[model samples]
Target: MQSSHVDITKKSAYVDAHIHLDTYSGAAQAAIIQLLEDDTLPLDYVVAVSMGLKSSQATQAWARRYPQRVLPAYGFHPEQALPTDAEVAELLAWMDVHQAEMAAVGEVGLPYYEREAAAKQGNVFSREPYVELLEQFVQRAAAWNKPIVLHAVYDDAPLVCDLLERHNVRKAHFHWFKGDADTVERMAANGYFISFTPDITYEEDIQALARRYPITQVMTETDGPWPFEGEFTGTVTVPTMVRDVAAYWARLQRITEQEAAVLLRENARCCYGY
Candidate 1:
């Protein structure tokens, strides 16, 4: 893999606050790990978030193999159908057994996209179960003293905020976040962190959010294997792309790219405790 041309100095590095490493093929995962191991790239760590038990297992394996690069986050993603009661119990048990190894409890929150799609199909979607499940994860994160990575956005953001506050989980990272001004202010007030994807290089809404958001609470992510547009169009999403996000975010915040890279990296380290 070609190294980044971002001119990152030894004083700074980038951390991908969120990514689905388990979604990639084994070969692709190996290639990405190789890039992460490359000192030439200004990348430091990739927080590999899981979709469920299976995904968590895979991510954990990678973390064990490449402890220097992969920081594994374990939890069920909310965009899919609810797992059975027994399955949920099993997953919780698995997470309990591996809690010490996880960076956070994540890829978990309310199902905004799925519910909206259901509504578009003229179907009523009940969010009660997802909310319950999210609360459980939030409770565990609070008890474990771990940051909770979130998929909550828009209207769902406020509700998830309620859970975080109720549990006193201040180290929340809302990855690839999108929300209204009030929610943004609320999250900022709570000292919660949010990450920008490569799309920040082009998306006006995301840029606006970047402008409104406090840079101290900001970080960069790729949510890799999830493609983007603009300059990233047709290119495979990789963790190194966070350098591009940090660069664009610097322009948005009117700071130097190196400054953005250091701030974002430190924010992720603070939030994830890595």
Candidate 2:
């Protein structure tokens, strides 16, 4: 027996923190997409992110097509190979072309997990050039004045932070944060918000991190398409399951579900500049 491709689906009435809807879908219909709402929670919204230069525009289009329910962020994903400056330049041009429609700059950062594992897969991922490319996008974002969604962890977090600080780009959000205590504390002090997923429900380290961090600085996310199974053998994910993330955080903070929901939404708004 073998585990089939993950059938990542959203549960009832939840918000997916991060996802690439373009993965399974294509760019053709990406422009006129209709974001469906979970029947259980029709009022909830989902944040869709672009994987790289290829998909940013379509992601933006999806968000534009459904502004009230979708928040779209654009950028290059670092785990994959770096794209040419010409490609990045085109993306920036696209940004200029549709500045009013973008949600934020995101899905970009050093690939601590994937890049390191590239050795086993016989691939290449040097940090110098990729970092430089990321810096260029960061500068463009700063010039445009939009919040950035980051995909860095641990050591990469500091470098990303340093670059952001040097560039004076203040609105930075670290998704799925798993950096050092000192780094987390520093990020918190700098007013950088870190979001959690359902992983917090089972991961002791995540629970500990949530307990120490200020609720005001902490937020919940689904990171949908990536399900987290706590005690269950194999669980699945969807936007609606974000409520579980909120509940877990609330439980860790000794707060009510309602209060957690309000705070999470506020934190998300603050992070994404919504």
Candidate 3:
């Protein structure tokens, strides 16, 4: 009956922390408002993510529109790739041109697609290309004092951590981490971050993960447009769903949701220098 009825007041500011904005530009602006419209949600900012080199343009534009709220991170996802060296070089050129446009490097890591496993997809799955590229790019970020928003996890998580350590990349956020205990321990010991999305709201494995690690080691995300399926009934996931995830973590950790929200927001800001 009233706006307050839709919004509830929570403690501290809220952040989606990590999201794919370019992929959902059709509803980007409207969704931004919707996610935090409820006073109960109280989102203060969002960390928009780029899934590819080209996605940077749209993502940056949208983030610029909401500079006070959306900070953009750009990169090329290992899930997709170009066919030749020239094409890869073209991508590198694009990154060079837009280096100043992003807050971090991300959504970029190893490929796990079936075709990539059999070489049916060729070199896209090979860590060689992106790993070498990251070697160069990581330094550029350090010179700029920007963090890296990582996508590699599971068996690949350890490798990502290794590179971050070798390059002295201090600010790293691994979204949707499902890595083994050894890897998780390394990340925790190294002070890297892992984000949980709607995936944890229902999945027992993710819930177990939440229980395995302390709340301070976790943050919230939606990985919008990437459905988690337990809920949402096959509907499109949006960054706003991150609110549910924040609450879920608080519940799992047996702390007030508001308290967890505060910690998560801090972690997000630290990763992106917000």
Candidate 4:
């Protein structure tokens, strides 16, 4: 978990707008958190999003331990089996109790990968329940007036957008987004933010997105513990990887890498309010 020894002084500082810090091992988490104290790195803060109640608790603890660097977000990820009614209630109640500490309600959205896999296996995937669950989280985010970090993409993006619109929740960050032109236009028009991961460095589709989407509504993330290909094939994914992401994004947007870094960092700060 050592820092990627890239020289970042040439680039403007940036933030990992979305990451799952709790998913890393204890030692890896320690090493990563320790790097945040190093001023030489371009990394400023990491928005650590949670997977569930236990994950949220661990994220909160990390935030407490490193108050200046870790910005914790609490919510259940939608890729797994649905929680029971009591479990859902418990998570909601716990989130309410720690609402003041959370940077946003996040890692929440409809399950695209899971659904696709089920369909490929000739199984009927029930989406209504997932939609209902996302609605509950959206309602809470609206009530708390907190920004929301989402895992929504493709076909699920429009449905999630509907819930956001219904609840009048505008501060939405769609992490690692991939969707059609119309959905992109809708999200951009609504002023919702989307973050690019290291894959942007080599993925033509992601690069195309960086060009089509408004630069002002964009940010950078690692989604660490989720490896990448291309130039990052063997390296441990870290926050500093965003520097390269920003560099590639700048090339696409016809801007300086430093300028892209600043824009992306500000966009994240504006959306997450950290």
The global C-alpha lDDT for each of the candidates, from Candidate 1 onward, is 0.89, 0.72, 0.71, 0.88
Model 4, global lDDT: 0.88
Cα-based RMSD of the predictions, in order? 4.5, 8.0, 5.9, 5.1
Give the worst 10-residue stretch by lDDT in candidate 2.
1-10
Task: List, residue by residue over 188-207, the lDDT tens digit for candidate 1.
Answer: 99999999999888889999
Model 3, global lDDT: 0.71
Write down the TM-score of every candidate.
0.95, 0.84, 0.84, 0.94
Model 2 lDDT per residue over 1-274, tens place? 1112221242223355576665534432232143353334533566777877668877776677667577888888887866777887887777678766666788888878876798779988678887887897688668878878889898899999888888888777788889898898888788887878878889999889888876766666766556467652365455556777888787877766666676677666666665
Q: Encode model 3's per-residue lDDT on 243-264: one tens digit a residue.
A: 7888888788776667777777
| Regions more than 4 Å wrong, model 1 | 1-10
The TM-score that candidate 4 achieves is: 0.94
lDDT of 4 at 200: 92
Residue 13 of model 1 has an lDDT of: 82
Name the top TM-score candidate.
Answer: 1
Ranking by TM-score: 1, 4, 2, 3
- lDDT preference between candidates 2 and 3, better one: 2
Q: Residue-wise lDDT of candidate 4 within 1-99, one digit each (tens)?
A: 111222335547889888888888776667686687787887889999999999999999989987868899999999999999999999999999999
